[model samples]
Target: MPNRRAALLALAAPMLALHLPLHAADAEQAPAQLTTVPGPFRADAGSLKTYQAPAWFRDAKFGIWSHWGPQSVPRAGDWYARNMYVYGSDQYKHHLAKYGHPSKFGYKDIIPLWKAEKFDPEALMALYKKAGARYFVSMGVHHDNFDLWDSRYHEWNAVKMGPRRDIVGDWRKAALKAGLRFGVSEHLGASYGWFATSHGYDQIWPMLGVAYDGADPKYESLYHRPHNQPYRNSASWYTTDKRFQQEWFNRITDLVTRYQPDLLYTDGGIPFGAVGRTLIANFYNASIANHGGKLEAVYDHKDIGSGEFIREAGVQDVERGVMEGINPLPWQTDTSIGDWFYSEGYKYKTTTEVVHMLADIVSKNGNLLLNVVQYPDGSLPPEPQQFLKEMAAWMDVNSDAIYGTRPWKIFGEGPTKAAAGHFQENTAYTAQDIRFTTKDGALYAITLGTPTGAVRIQSLGRKAGLEPRPVKAVTLLGSATPLRWEQGDDALTIQLPATLPSAISSSFRISF
Candidate 1:
């Protein structure tokens, strides 16, 4: 099998090589040069192999993301644009009932409905900082092909249409004001084919013969022209069309050039082969130019574990999933409170679930980028606001264990094994489950749930085979006095106080 795989890769070498250096030559000749030489990244895996995640990204463990956009306008949750085109789908029915048929009132009509009148970046940024977010990410563009930022290339943008505001710029200003790193997420790569559904017609309808608005050539730029294949095909995620690829390159390049965000997140794996590589290279090169030769920018994309190109170029981002153990390199998990976009009646993850997930991910050398859903009017409902408040109160007492910490020898001690991969169910941790993180020679043992009378950590036992270090001092994070503890060969038992410090997870700082 290994020999066969190697033979296939060898046969594909020429095809892969065709994608290299597409923009490297042009970037080298640009008049306003960002770097003396060509950009730091290249389209091939060889050049990107030198990339490493920066220290700032590794330290800024927790980040808040606003996945807000016109898709939330209908309050029907994620994939509203595409799903609304899918015949017999819930969104399709909702669109038909709410406004009209796709032939008349489509996603284009929904764009103007996003007023964002209640959206106050300054106020939201303050809440995020208080909730312990070290970084903020704003939606630059989703699969709908609408730019949330002020776009110079495309006319379908936030400034000209929805909200009449540069959403990315406002979020960036707010994040910087709150001393938080800012990032942007671009889902445009898959959008070309993803939005192909817009060009489709209802198979069984009174208007069956009539085509959707996407078929109109006047709006072809906004609703992308139909591709050869059906929607949601794996290969179609990043379309094979050269015209679309070039457009993707131009728009993303404009985004990086205009914003110079601290981080850039691609919704899928590095896309469009050579064009994608050029985008990453230009991003890094521009970042270095902005930071006086020190690249502070970080790029994140999905890693399927088979692609060396993704593993080498940027931080691996798992969508609604987790790594099984401590990854040799830093990575991230981008999940949301409820639906990716706002849904009228969606249930959100509780604060306890979020905190426990954070601790578990951090213990495995991972960061969490959580999306707090917002309404179409740009306001969070009572439930999400309460969620943020709870997070703030918890962070007030236990943030020392979360920020600027590294994984310990072992991630945790627990019986409930967390299922690994995207879309897996969240683990329900018991009081016995414990996660570990460390900083400045101190170990922090975070109990997933508050224990009653006594807490025992088997990982710290003398005979646990980890060659465990002797505990010299142990103190509860929010408590003033030290706790009484005894170490045995089998387990380390600590007598807990009748009352706990925080209502959520409890942390014990251990010094050797």
Candidate 2:
């Protein structure tokens, strides 16, 4: 497998070079109301304020985000950058067939085609709630340079162009009415430079003179046409651009004031300037003001000093992966079953895969914010919808082992192991892998895979030479009758029922 950092840098390289200049005037200019600090990080105080992340968020183990935007119109996998490069790539082929050539249509034109036709917010919310999602996060803006909200700062917004409605407002209303915390993700920061690939063309193609229309005068804002740095064919082309950096600032500020979401997530670290600092401060202050300064806010930003800004004021989130080891503050890994958006050929994760991933993440002291991709018309694909139903069915009966629980003496006895970081390949866990969580002094042991009949746990009351706590009772979650158990010096054995509630996995709660 390719090194994870190299893959991450591949994602970050285009944006960093395009948006950060060695010397730029606007980088020094402080927004009127925003705080001013230099560099990419926000400073951390010695002691963080006493702030509790909202109760609803803590209880909400699952959420769904509409990562869709103009990008989904291509019906391709995520990352329009690399996909648009390979001529044979599904996205590239889709771009060519649906919209003429990559040159004429470019990505900019697709922005208008995202009609969001079947976008019935209330109906979608109902389905999400039914699927066991406790919160909803709508895409406020993606790296495609389009805002889903009614932006006062930019004309490239859903209300003015494509959907012709305040997408964020509709979703917020629906989520709040359903008693779900509303959040907005900001991929706008990286948009400044990430989309610079709009200027390049495939080296070998079906036809010649097929460069994308990044420099077209009429569509400058949509493509982020930077004035000082001319588009070049060099690999370092976007990294040296200056104008894109300034535009990045303007777009993010507009998003902050317009949405005021309960959660604000940046695609990467904030910009490398005082403006970035101000953006962070404003995000916190806005959350404080929105909740009358009582409820703590959440900002899912990256590269902010470790335990610095997050430990002090906000929460941290990982995209498509999780942290290497356990973390002090609560963190989340955002991923989906298949593509980030709905694609006809996309394969959703199996119920077993999803359940085990959740259990593993919780065991390591993290949360899983899963995204179930919905079709452009706002309907979930049958496969994902079915997967959600199965997951909900499992969660319904075994939720006691998950929600409102903390890691126990050890996070289970298991032979199963998951990768430690982002974009790592997922490996299957065997029945031997067990994850543990505790609540009210009761230990909940979850097996990654279902056992045939009886199960033995070697982690507790034996391996460590601790006092052998006799198994007073062992109950398989979601089953009608409590399973019988007997304890020996080395392990505790429990009888499994003839039938199981779920084929994916099972859990047991052992009370002292």
Candidate 3:
């Protein structure tokens, strides 16, 4: 009987191994302590002030982000997970009609539905590289409390459920193979308070008194307990509870220790004050340890010139808006192609608009982290693919004007003024709108639109009051023919060829 049992156990071992996730197995085998030191950063404002943005991040001006996850499962656009619990909300209505009520089929049910079978990290990374992305950011975790990596601290992770794949690990591997810097964006800071609505039930009719699945104690780990004081608005996104703050610190620390990403982006302001500082310090210290004591990691947040911690800590990230001028410190603008997530029938930004935004942001010493929305099956729709193709063509011709360039004296000259602050309207630029960037003693003037016969740059004029520099020669970036040009006190005029270099925005390299 013992011999027969041993044979049966041996036969079942292979089947069990086959069923287990590859990343989970790898995590189990890894040494408990991988780094030489746990961390070198402290939970104080003064300790964090010593940090600075890395040069590599400054040089790598553009990055692409995979802002995807189970929230994208419904294809209803951004904030589906949170909004679905809100009674009478559009997503709530959709959930009731399609899947059932939140009382029965809540976000938990949607989690298993995200198969992500078509997700090909290598292929997608190759495409992003072709689009001229210097860096790539993957969504490590969002407000839904679902970690994308092979998380040891949390059971509700990608390896254990949902896609059942180590999404972050796979993305990092692909980015490294493609020779691009890898980064991760963590929206987990606000998870505790943001998900409070999940504990709510319908106030109307048949299911009025029934509690949502979030009220079940069995799934408490996934859907956190309702906070005594729920978040009333964005100002209260982060909870004051010490327990949630500690949890945030532990989870984010685990992420940094495990991945050692080149960049760490926080969705909101450095959260929970001291705890947030600790997380930032750990991320920085871990990055330094990984790179042999020289810090290469960049921590991005959304606080602009406000608190002492924010101003001194890391790069400021502006969401859905542009700065008025060149910031004294380096910054970034993280916007999306369309909606934050996949939304059917949503109008996306045009290729021209994207290029224009990129040029405008770069001219003001800011990086543009564009989110290219992906479908649940991990494939890009035809519209986004077309946008990428067009961007690739534009980058092929005018990438020199973008990469490794600094802002000129002025950002640009245009009638269309960009509305400042978050959620501002995007303005369309005409032919007259011009942005400037300088690289290796050469100045690049990028027109927001195609010029007619000749292009006039008033900024280069002697009388513009801006100190004039002598121009040696002028040539189009994608064209070899020397452009006919004259520099005068009034304006610097350049003759255009019968055919433009590229159909999109044109770049003229002015060598001094």
Clashes of 2: 2
How far out, in Å, is residue 111 in model 2? Answer: 1.8
Output the lDDT of residue 278, model 2.
Answer: 56
- Candidate 1 stretches with Cα past 4 Å from truth are 1-37, 304-309
lDDT of each: 0.82, 0.66, 0.80
Candidate 2, residue 386: Cα displacement in angstroms equals 1.1
Q: Rank the candidates by TM-score, best first.
A: 1, 3, 2
Ranking by lDDT: 1, 3, 2
What's the lDDT of the predicted structure labeled candidate 2? Answer: 0.66
Determine the C-alpha RMSD for candidate 2 after optimal superposition of all C-alphas. Answer: 4.9
lDDT of 1 by residue, 4-29 (tens): 11232232233223312233232233
lDDT of 3 at 78: 81
lDDT of 2 by residue, 1-512 (tens): 01112343443344334542344653445333444323323333321233446655655667777787777776776766334533455566777777776667777677777888988889878777876677788888776778888887788889998879998889999998998778888766555445655554554546633556664667778766543332222222223333454565566667666666777766555444445555666666566666665554566655432112334445666666656555656677778887876676877788888888777767656677777787765667788778878877888878888876766656666665566655653778888788887778788888888788788887654555543465577788888776777776667787888898777888888887
Candidate 1: pairs in clash: none
The residue-level lDDT of candidate 3 at 118 comes to 93
Question: TM-score of the candidate numbered 3?
Answer: 0.91
